[model samples]
Target: MPIRRRLGYLPALVLIFFLCVLLYAFQLHSLISTSRSIDGIEQTADQLDNYKDEPPNKAQLKLQNSPLENEADTADKALLESPVQDWVKFVRLSDDIFLYSVILDLRDGNMDYPCVRIVAIVRRRQSITCNFAGNSSVAASFYELSENHGLSYGAFVLSCKIPQQIKPETVTSFIVQQDETKTYVNVQYTVTEKVPPSMPLTYGICIPVLYGSRYGAANLVEFMELNRIIGAGHVFIYLQHDRLSAEMIKVVNYYKAKRMLTTLEFKLPVSEQIIWYYGQLLAIQDCLYRNMGFAKYLAFQDLDELFVPYSSENIVSMLNPLFSANSSLASLRIPTRYIKASEEELAHPPLAMKLTMAAEAEDVLFTKCVVRPEMVFEQGIHHTSRVIQHHYQTVALPSSFGQLHHYKNYPSSVSNERVPKTYGKKFLARYEQVISELQVKS
Candidate 1:
């Protein structure tokens, strides 16, 4: 009886042991599966951390499905299909009037709506019709931009409000209609868009119309080198193509190839009726708007003029501190120091190093400006005509900082002084390099 009872107890113990082993195996399987799940979650988190700054492919997929992407596609399509207009030459609209460009002006603080400004050289006052997209038409208001120089034909900006139903960005072209002697003439102009967001250039030089045959390639090369040495990132020249020489064109093409110069072909429809230089203000307006969102600061002066710093190596170094100190500074009025070119120098133009004799600082009337283009509404040859007055101010820089070295022929009786030798050595080195390069190229 005792043996039989012991055998019954053994079987029961074996059954309990088997049940414990099964429970242990089940727990080990669950633990391994949970560990794998945790590892996967950590890997996913690491991937997110790696792409925190820049979105991953998944994010791009989301953007591709967004409404903003659709809008961008539509804008791109509209731009591609828009009619191509010649923006380089002045289009003849009538006998006495010519259109230069059509620009979307959104800088008006007082007006609630945007307007299209038609840049033209109008000899006489006349009413014109501006036709927009969707068959909308409005009478344009004329604003004369003469700086009181008393030229027969001057720059006029014909402004017409954009139709409320039409979007400004969608506007690619507009038609101008003028009634002349019971006959109507219609001319279409491509509209230049508003300012962009990215500014790639920090400093630029705007040279008014180069219309005379007197300027040679040598002097132009010297001027460009000098300005480049003094921190001119880009130079914009409005070339009256028919007026300039082949040598000048070659030099322009060389600089353009290097991406340092941009030339806009400029011509007058009726050159005899208008003084050639009188259209400088019009070129300035075009350049101002062209560089509005492209360059941070633009120097408005001729090829013969240069901004020379007193102590700093470049103009940017001298002005950076001032800008940092005064955020509202819109322009810097650099006093002019006239450097009289001798007869010999004029006959055979010498390098900037040879031209040292300069005049004392002149009054504000003879000053030129380096302006922040976005802050200026209307620019003049020597100053800004219209600026956002509420937040912007023009400061006249002292001679100690810098001066505009104007190299030209002056009367012998005028007092003379030596230009500060701040940049003479550096300019000489760079000028020599440029001469050597030109000689090699030739």
Candidate 2:
């Protein structure tokens, strides 16, 4: 009787187990189906987004069986369009070399590259055009440099080669056009005589600066004024960005309007700025090359570093003695003396008065330099290398005669964090006039 009863319950147990298995199978199938649906939705959403943002022409170009006729039409349309006109700019790098910058806003739109052939119309008499496709590698190298420097976007820095016969000073503008697309951009080149005829071998200062918050308004004014009061006849400033203070702009404009300062704009988007500072080297080189015939002496120094005289009133007076002694000197290496800020000075802040009054110590700083523009083949940040044929020759000026008064050693709010030592006494008393003049101008 017990055996028969156990056999009867076995069928019920089997039935229950089968039902559970069936339920689990159904749930698993539902979950997988839902997951597939979600994946498909996500893929569709991504495709939609890409379609909206990316140009239809770009997608068509990627297709294997894409119609060549359609592509030709698109290219023709692009050639007809002129997007580079707003972004393209030109700077005369030298008599034979021109610097052109084109902002590649590929992310923003489908902007085709300008033509390899660039034309320059000189006084509407002579038209000089060169096939620049071979130099595309140079532009690629500049993009790499910007990436190395920490920039995120692509920019083309074309060291445009001009004919030896065409005087860059006489050329008014450049025309960049894509013949296939019929698109073009006009870049205007300002050909002003920066140096006077009488002062042909003039001394100018080149300061290549990307934008930064560290350059204070009051400081910049005083800096330019001090250099002006010193021996710097012309100031060549390359500003990477236009985001400058009103006071700084005023100072720049004041000198620029008077033709004492040549201001060149560097159009590296703020979003693409890198910290490498190699652009400084390029700027220094560009400045040297551009001013080769214009300026006799080119001083490569920061706005913060001022060349002062010990006994003489100004740098012109100070350098007169050197010129008298060494007529053949191609360059002069001025030793830098770091002037540190005192704790009291930092706290009180004599910005209203002479800012240099607070400087106390005579710390050793990096060497600053002033070189003949024609002799320099290349330029480093601190010093310059001579031409391949010419040997490097520099005269080290004695400290007793005067030195560069660098305000870096001082305990300031901006850069140096080390506790500044008190060395005592100030050497910038002669700069009081310039500083005061800057204060009034500001």
Candidate 3:
């Protein structure tokens, strides 16, 4: 009876225990919910306080800290300013305008600064800058002038870092601006393409001779042989006509076979060939572009002219000091000392004999030259018209160094100082032997 009474009390006691545990759990849950609500209220209050102290917008910040304000300030400053053009007083357009290209060899031992040089011919004593409309401004300046010859002209090479960025097909223009005046003249521009890579030549000659059937065989032989003796690396001759003497043909064939000379035949209708001088200019320019890859220096001259160096026998040896002295030397004008043949020599007529035996200097002409392949663009018969301008002296070689040997007309006065027959004698002898053999064969 006692155990039953205890069991019945146990059920009521267990119910009471369960009810207390459930009430305690609900109180704990309520406490956590109230704490979370208080935290949310505090966060809202902190956000409201932040806005009251300082607005979170750029309008309230300093101008330096605000990009939009800085932009506005810059725009206002620009509006208040005038256009800034370069100063333009001393520079002006040249009366004779010429444009051209050159193949410049920047070879210093292993490092070569080879580039296809562009040039513009102008007239001004002060340095002028060239600005390519959308391209680079020419950093080079005029290093030469024609003031001594009673002419005021300058040849400027257009140089800058932007030329390489120019597309070959892009058609643009350049403006020539004077340094002081900042005055500029605009001209059409055609980008000169770089020549195909090749082995560098020490010296080369381009003789744009207008040859025809009536051309003298002996004169042609002497011209080629003389250049060969002077150590011409390559010789280019443009034959303007079809007919050639047997001796001339033999000489051309001999040099061509030796790979020392190249010949191009120029053929055109009489109407197209109306101007002989223009034809010559075109031929010379063509020869320049053609040989840009093959030569370090190129000389454009007549077949009758020779620049014999007094210091050294060959032209190459004379060039070393000239180049060294004027580091930026592009074109060098060596005075021409005309040596007219005697009447007795002219009567003989071959011309080669006259050159061999001629003595005494009669007239002196001071403006014939050989130019660095990369510094000249358009070549005139007597001198180069367009050259690159750099910060270096572009004076001609002094007459003391050498003078041109021009063989034409009769000697005005005879002197004991006869030209030594020994200069280029070996080549002359070979040419004579070849002509004799060809004559005998014919």
All candidates' TM-scores? Answer: 0.72, 0.49, 0.53
Tens digit of lDDT per residue, candidate 3, span 1-442?
A: 7888879899899999999999999999999999999997886565545522123432322222213322121222221121211111112243343333322333221111322234444434445465655746656433332222333333344443235565434423345555444433322222234433432466777776555433456556666666666666666776643476566777676655444566766442222333344245545665665544446667777776776676677677888788767766777776666566654544343454445433355233445667765555455666666553444234566666666666656444553122355453576576677568556221
lDDT top scorer: 1
Residues 46-131, model 1: lDDT tens digits: 76555321234433223222133221212222212223221345777776678776677666443223777767888887878878
Residue-level error in angstroms, candidate 3, position 389: 2.8
Lowest-scoring 10 consecutive residues by lDDT in candidate 3? 80-89
Q: 89, model 1: CA deviation in Å?
A: 1.3
- Report the Cα lDDT for candidate 1: 0.68
TM-score of the candidate numbered 1?
A: 0.72
C-alpha root-mean-square deviation, candidate 3: 27.6
TM-score of structure candidate 2:
0.49
lDDT of 1 at 24: 100
**Best model per TM-score:** 1
Deviation in Å, model 2, residue 194 alpha carbon: 19
lDDT of each: 0.68, 0.47, 0.51
